[model samples]
Target chain A: MSVQPQTQARTRRTWLRVFLIIPFIVLLYPPFYNSNDPTFIGMPFLYWFPLLWILLTAILTGALYFLGA
Target chain B: MFTFNPVAFTVFIIFFLIVTGMGFIAARWRRGDLDQINEWGLAGRRFGTTVTWFLLGGDLYTAYTFIAVPAAMFGLGVLNGWFAVPYTILVYPIIFILMPKFWSVCKQRGYVTAADFVKDRFGSRTLAFAIALTGIIATLPYIALQMFGIQVSLAALGIPLSVSIGGLQIELPLLIAFLILAAYTYTSGLRAPAMIAMVKDIMIFIVLIALLIVLPAKLGGFGAIFAAVAKKHAASPTTFFEFLSPKQNWAFVSLALGSALALFLYPHSLTGVLSSNSKNVVKRNTALLPIYSLMLGLLALTGYMAIAAGIKPPKSLGANYAMPLLINAQFPPWFAGFAFAAISIGALVPAAVMSIAAANLFTRNIYKEYISPNASERAESTVAKWASFVLKFGAVLFIIYIPTAQVINFQLLGGIWILQTLPAVFLGLYTNWFNRWALLIGWFVAEVLGTILFSAAGLKSVYAISIFGVSFPAMYTAFSMIILNLILAIVLTPIFNVIGLGRGRDITVATDYDAEEVLPVEAGREALG
Candidate 1:
């Protein structure tokens, strides 16, 4: 979890940063997940989709954190 | 005074006292000098992963989020309420990308405020002053709203917010609460809130978990709750939509994006970030802090739960009372008291941190930079402490004197105003290519035009503009204005350069943005001083 001090050259994994944009693209467009036809445990798609994304996005961010992007 | 439960009142008072006691004791928790601005304002930047997580969760989620998100769902349904879920989800990835660099640059320069980094990066005192002024003004109504959150909780508890003594009206209860808050904040600075944030967050989480489990069971289940929400929306098609209509789609997207972008730009959020010990701490917390967002999403559903419970808030308290009333209806008096204390204590943590953040801006960018160029570190810290007191007191008076609707309107505009700083603060992190004067011009134009647009939209944050008889769908005012702000800065930079306007010197080196800790070069500046 500690940043490496001896790594002089800055980690410019700018390509890895693209993974960060996935949640924004997925979650921002309500049209993509706005339907209620799909229900999870009685919650409609509209409701459950974003709630599920919260966990997914957290994992996405956690992955990014681990990759040191 | 509609339903005074003495048990709830006593329980609320007891928990309030516990946090107040903890607030005072926090000064010694990680003990730093009380007379240095960095030490006092940022807890000497020693917060590790877990502490920073709680501090930020408590800071960003806020009492406003606790009350208003559910309140919006209860009152206005999806567009108004559910957008917050996506907004919170989107913010962390943003923090994951942006804040580590911001923390790195600030640490390397000993920058106490974002405006401090802007001033150095752009080398424009006027631009820096613009940023400092905006941060302070934008946060003022926000702090007032935290007081409003406490007022709503007390009202729900049937406690008198004000009292008459000798024919003089006094907000005695709120005054007493704020005085206790002010005392500890003055004595302990950011440490008070950092310590208390741990308590506030745990209590909030417990309340959230209890409500999520207990309420759904009482009201059938999530299926039944959504059925109730859908039924209500069907009953009032004009007011509430169970899903985003085609036209409302862009507005929701923009609102979510705009607010997510604006959340961390607020000085208080950055105060939480800057207080952390390292970029890794900030990065780690971004991943962890979404736990609050998950809580917020469930909390927003409580508004739907209120609908399911058939709860109606009194006309005086309005929708904000829905969550508290739902609690009172479903939980016992003692639990209601604990929930109310969780909320009011929730309000106190952000209020303290925001005032400290705003005070830091004024001291570093305005007072020390302009009013007294030769201010000693002790003198600077002293000014910040007093400034924090004055700002909090001012907000208390603002809540007591002003209409809550007016405060809400200003807070809406505050969001728009703060995002205008992004060109200088957020974009300034990666590159210093933009001319200083160009960035200032961009900020000025965006702020003025944004306010005008907000007014044009009847002070709503969403507006649909028709240009040349071709109408565009409504979008978030902050989102639209930020685009304009960015375009203006980008177009003007080369123009300003070619016209022979000089750019300010950047004091930071490229590696500063990737540095793991405060650079020795910054320490050298302090030594020279």
Candidate 2:
């Protein structure tokens, strides 16, 4: 099941590269989004921002995977 | 409130029996020769994307996450609790990068455990032994926590705890539950959990979606839930809703980052990763497993719902009972039974995986390394199978004898110890410049200092310390210890090399870890690296 070298190089170019960076940005700086105001569906910003990123991160990961990275 | 409801118990038993039947049938499902260590321990390295997803999801998100994440919120708000959301989130990216390398390398070598890979990579048996011992010891308390999860469900169901038998009091239900787990795990090995996880995860998803949708409407919505929680915090100023205080900022960040780093270092997490058929299966699963993380976040919100609904645990079971009690209070009896069944079976899937992973460590790293170098593959399989039985039964006994709070504290302490391996196993994957003995010394220093700090803080599960009498507000001990560990390894490596000490030979090359897929079964079987 070894990938052809040409195919492997193309996989290396895929957006899967960004999979790790998005998390480091969202999770490392909690103070930026840590508040109970500006509520979404009656949930706090502090709570919902992290929850929202859960979906966004998943989408990012899936996009990268499909892009062949 | 605590009366025995036969309806809940009957539904619980019904689901329990179905899981048991699944367990027995799993041995022959995708049938393999059980005599080899590969078939017995790694599920023949044949889990594709779907099976790997369910297995990893089912294994990583266990009963403890179901019961305790919410309980952490119900009892103490942000610092102790909400870190779980980010902890779960950060784990995937970390696993995405690190675990595929692990899978490729382990596959190339026929290495069954992380310790087996470590043993070959650095050409150091002692270092591999350290890693294996750490894996076993670190996992035991976690397995014990799963048993505690079962105990919580039974307590809610009002199962008789101490039924006198043969002139001795025993936790009869807990004993019976573990015996069933041990039997199937012994007979079927990793396959039992792989099969049962599919059922456990679906049941949990159904329960969570139903409960989350209905509970918020029943309690008048998320705003009211948080309002009730805020009211409770205002009533008791010192305990709840510490997010505004900013005192716990370090604690929150460190707890999340530290645990995310520690998650995949665990033997069982590696067990799940190594069981997959290829690197792509693992990489794809990393993308999809976050669905479970989303479920975990919603489930953690249910803790506040327990508060808003005015559900209180009986004094004996304490706050951990918050989730189970809330289920019984809000749901009808049969649904509560299915919920409890979900929790009970959730505990089993991971428990089976942990024991199998730990047993493989024993068989490969310890038993084969020293006990009998030429031990047949059959002997290795036999050793791992019995070791799984004894190891899990021991975990069951550990929880029964110890207090649940202490078991939790002990598990936190286990996290501190396991993170010490970062320099040895995790870093060694990228580079082996550090002397093996330096890594060992770093691990020892971190273990001792982490323990002393944990003990110094009045045995608090999480603590921050005063260095040179400058007190820091609370931070996680594991994160602190890992920093000290990394520094020690960095500092001591060149110092050891300057003296007469020597670095071990690196037998593995970089390309070995870039293998595209696992070799054919016969080819992989023939090479005994």
Candidate 3:
């Protein structure tokens, strides 16, 4: 059950870095990609803004499980 | 302010009084050595899954979300209002990773606040003090925002309006509300607030579900509602449908992401985590709390309904009153009263929890540490109780003095300030590589820079820039500050390490996260010592 301090610390760092970067990529790209026309399930990129959080949650949870576990 | 129905007002008062009575009794819910800080402030760290779920929901979904989210959507259109949905979704996973470790460490060391853990891990009172100070300071405006939520709800209920004489209003009813809340919170601590949260959550569900069902019928139908919204957007294209535009998309994403990171870092959220009895409780709550987020999405739809129903907010009132106005305009008088009570109760539970969290920080970090290092457990608990009272009173003052229109800005301003604490909190949770002094320095830089940018943008109510000739609000300001904070910490940590300013100390050997299922000997010793 005991995790080596070094390994745990490294895992924590990796998770932190991923958290910092993922939001940037997800938020920054979609606006640019769909600047001309945005559509997801007949919803505009604007309408999809809130729903994007679903993907963000999955990514964050997956990363946390990977690193923390 | 509308006229309050006599029968409805009577019922609401009776319900509120009953809850207040229960809160006082809650002081004894989880009986323990009443002398200790943990026993008083964290309910002896013994809440199981069901209680913890209700507790966290009550703590997180405040009157702000209840009134403000729908109000924002109703007033500004869908783009601005979507922030709540994402922010709630993001908070779950972040906490899932962080809370289990936090719980383990806190339980093992008998720590009452995050500052206690920082102090133990770093072996530096200064660092711990900084953490405590940041937590208390950042949480104050938040507490004030809750009071603001109450004031908005009360104003909508016609309580404050009826008291107005010539332009001089007597806010006696609102004052009375704060006094009642302060009394119960001082008596019962965490138990008082946790117990009340159950009532608050139930009321919220009832009111929201009723509004969702009833409002569409009032608005003619979903198609009519959307059509009205479309017309509104068509008239003002810049503010409404164009999501990728600066005011909408970037600000929405940035605010969502920034808030998600900062949400659990708040001392109140940490209080929720440390109060849990087991790690499984935290994990289970994490997966299930999304149900609240789903409710939040449904709640956001009320704004669209308001627009369709043609419910225009009064000139003096803020957008936060839109939902209340819509309810009064559309629902039966008794139902409107019930919905108003839901919002009022929503403000009460979170405000109570917030003050308790702030008070705990003051007692554990300030009073017990520098003020009297050898302070007894009883003395610490006493300080926490008094601090909670004073903090709630201060929030009452904030509600009284600040104009309602400015209250929303103050909430956002509070967010900007609190987000400054992320590097110190989220980073320090796992590593000692961040020098205490470096963390402090980073906090200072971020606070200064973020404030300047936010203010200089002229409270433009939006910060946008031209990217390839498209205008977008500069939503990334918080993210920018966090980045700057991290960079400052990273840069200064090594320099301080080289200079031996804040050398790493021995962290507790027992990994508290793993201690969740099993009762570690260290946890027992720490708790009973």
Output the better candidate (1/3) by DockQ.
1
Candidate 1's residue-wise lDDT over B435-472, tens digit each? 99999898999899999999988878899977899998
The segments of candidate 2 whose C-alpha lies over 4 angstroms from its true place after superposition are A1-19, B242-244, B518-529
Give lDDT tens digits, candidate 3, residues B198-296. 888898899878886777776776667767877777888765653445445666677778888888878898898888887766866776677777777
- Report the error of model 2 at residue B22, Å: 0.8
For all candidates, state DockQ relative to the true structure. 0.77, 0.63, 0.20
RMSD of 3: 5.2
Model 1 chain A weakest lDDT span, ten residues long = A1-10
* Residue B431 lDDT, candidate 2, scale 0-100: 86
User: Who is ahead in DockQ, 1 or 2?
Assistant: 1
Q: How accurate locally, in lDDT, is each candidate? A: 0.89, 0.86, 0.74
- Model 2, residue B251: distance off in Å is 0.8
Worst 10 residues of 2 chain B by lDDT: B520-529
Q: Give the higher-TM-score candidate: 1 or 3.
A: 1
Deviation from native of the Cα of residue B118 in model 2, angstroms: 1.1
TM-score of 1: 0.95
lDDT of 2 at B454: 85
- Model 3, position B412, has a per-residue lDDT of 67
Ranking by lDDT: 1, 2, 3
Q: Candidate 3: which pairs clash?
A: B104-B512, B246-B472, B246-B473, B463-B473, B463-B474, B464-B472, B464-B473
Cα RMSD of predicted structure 1: 4.3
